[model samples]
Target chain A: SQQGEEDPQALSIQEGENATMNCSYKTSINNLQWYRQNSGRGLVHLILIRSNEREKHSGRLRVTLDTSKKSSSLLITASRAADTASYFCTPGGSGAGSYQLTFGKGTKLSVIP
Target chain B: DVKVTQSSRYLVKRTGEKVFLECVQDMDHENMFWYRQDPGLGLRLIYFSYDVKMKEKGDIPEGYSVSREKKERFSLILESASTNQTSMYLCASRLAAYNEQFFGPGTRLTVL
Candidate 1:
């Protein structure tokens, strides 16, 4: 079963524009993480926002968590052509001393130059 | 740099054949995971191991088995391959304390 569901299945924008993707999960999570994947490549971890944290930023990536609503969002500021890829949100929870994460169907962002 | 390597970037196999996918990590991370990615469905975890010889099934573990005989290596085995089993296989590892996971280049498997 998929724990997270990302909205805006696909998005297209011009270079330098901002792109935002949202995710909603069903269960309580210890942290929410964002990842990027280029075509034919493995996923790269972008940032992690813990349950206690409301927001986090790294480079041009900003992540906000609303635990009360069981939702999270990733915002990319000034996106570029290089930013065209699939963005995934993973909600992680720990059980019996091990952490388990489930990834949602990603939001495919296309940045046209 | 943390490096995770898979045995092959692409593989073609016949139906009913036993297939093995290998993964190795150089970072000495304690937790390793195997996931399969497909169109629309995204990535689904097949199995994970926290330590040598200790394995646990993930959400979609049917038709898949895993082996973790060594600390640095993890192997996912397909008991008998089928056309439906063809997908991109990804391997990832993370430290016990960290939430970030490092992933290997995926293997695109085609079962004919």
Candidate 2:
């Protein structure tokens, strides 16, 4: 399975603090993508990092990928109460059938105001 | 902007009743997918259509069927709703060249 498993199934933090979540996959991937979902809402794409790239950033969110370790991490700087949500990662691959990115149980985040 | 919309944000149905969940995307994406989200199970793909009249079963396609009669519309049909089928159904669409998927608000289905 090329599924990306997120560590620390849940996390809690105070507003304005930084929150980090880790994801590890079993096999090599061409790229990796992260998504955020609010309570009872659909997921929103956060960022994507390719194999040749080590890090990418979007607004206050930063993502890093280590191909050698087959792991990726998402860092949210200065987390806000509105940032309380679940984060998910999915492995990306090449080929005609690589579009069906399967997701794993995500890391649920809680930011207290 | 890419927008995916589901028929309902919440749905309630009794066991053995037929259910239909509709999804529409305004981006004219070539790929559309249906998935069910559950606690601890993440998101499991139920079905996906690459183009009109093209459908493929995903990891968990049992008890679920899909129809893609038009480019922007994809419908998921449950022949006989069951208690185990109760879940949050999500619809997503993506361009063929991109890996990022645009998702709908999701429909929370409750089966009694």
Candidate 3:
């Protein structure tokens, strides 16, 4: 199973605060991607970190991958009300059974204003 | 921009009714997928197509089916809609197996 399980199923934070989420997988991966989903909208890709990469950043979002540990983390800096959304991690690779894209249960983040 | 569109934003159907949800992508991607999302279960793959008329069952494909007769279109069908089938259906398309997938707005299906 390439599924990544997100830690801290839910998180609440105040505006301007930084929130961090972690994900752990049972198997190795070629790449890992983080996504954000608003209340009822489709997922928007945030960042992708390849297995060889240690960390990647886009805007305020930072994603890190540690294949040796089969774990990943996503950090959001200076959170805002508009940043309130559910975050998910997906692990994909070139190996068989990686095409299914089994996503994690997700971490629901609530940024209070 | 990669564009993926679904046929409906919300749909209501009764049990035992045949339901059809359609998705279309403008990027002409060869890989398309269907997934169902619930409150706590995250996203579960229902089916995927690698090419026209080629479909593969995903993690959860018991009561669902998919069709890809054209390169740009994929459809998910509920043979007999059930109450348990109520979920947010998402469609995504990828240029290749390792590329990031572009998702549609999603269709919220309510089975009564």
Candidate 4:
């Protein structure tokens, strides 16, 4: 399985603090995406970074990808209580017409207000 | 807004009984996928459909099968429910392989 493995299975931080999670995969990927899931709910896509891209940001979320290391990281700055949820990293392959993604066990983040 | 709807939010079945889970997407997506999420296993793909009648097996397709008779609907079938099959099942759809997928609220199945 070329599934990505997230570091720090769980994290806790006070509101206004930064939270960072890392993911490492074993194979080359075409893109990596970050998704957030509320308790017992479907996941919502947060961001997508292509293999060629090194870094991207959206609002308080920042994503960095390193193809050389087959790793990526997600940074949430000034996280709020609402940001308490599970985060997953999905690495997509370059296969034609194959949009299948391998998801890793997510990082559970808790933001205390 | 893209919306994916599952047939049920919760289901219970007995061993040896047949079970069916339905999913429908309103986004006219060309790719649809079914996955089962377990506590420590993350999300494991069960099956996917690329077109109206084209279906493909995913990583763990042993005891599951799928049907895609229409573009908007996909169905997962468990030939005979078993205790080990209890888990949360999720349905997702995307316009293409690289596009962001929209997922439905999962169905939590309990096999007894």
Tens-place lDDT per residue, model 2, A1-113, is 26899988999999999999999998778889999999655699889899899999899999999999999999999999999999999998767547688889999999999
Docking class of 4: medium
Clashes of each: 0, 0, 0, 0
After superposition, candidate 3 runs with Cα above 4 Å error = none
Q: Give me the chain B TM-score of candidate 2.
A: 0.98
What does DockQ give for each predicted structure?
0.68, 0.68, 0.70, 0.73
lDDT of 4 by residue, B1-112 (tens): 9999999999999999999999999988999999999998899999999899998888999999999999999999999999999999999998988777788999999999
Docking class of 1: medium
**Candidate 1 lDDT, B1-112, residue by residue in tens:** 8999999999999999999999999989999999999997889999998889999899899999999999999999999999999999999998873368999999999999
lDDT of 1 by residue, A1-113 (tens): 33678889999999999999999988777888899999755589999998999999999999999999999999999999999999988888756533567787889999999
Off by over 4 Å in 4: none
Instruction: Please give the range of 10 consecutive residues that has the lowest summed lDDT in model 4 chain B.
Output: B94-103
Instruction: Supply the global lDDT for candidate 2.
Output: 0.92
Model 3 scores a C-alpha lDDT of: 0.91
Those runs of model 1 whose alpha carbons end farther than 4 Å from true positions after fitting are none
What is the per-residue lDDT of model 3 for residues A2-66, given as tens digits with 9 covering 90 to 100? 78889889999999999999999887788898888996556888888898999999999989889
Comparison by lDDT, 1 against 3, better one: 3
Q: Say what the RMSD of model 4 is.
A: 1.3
* lDDT, model 3, position A54: 100
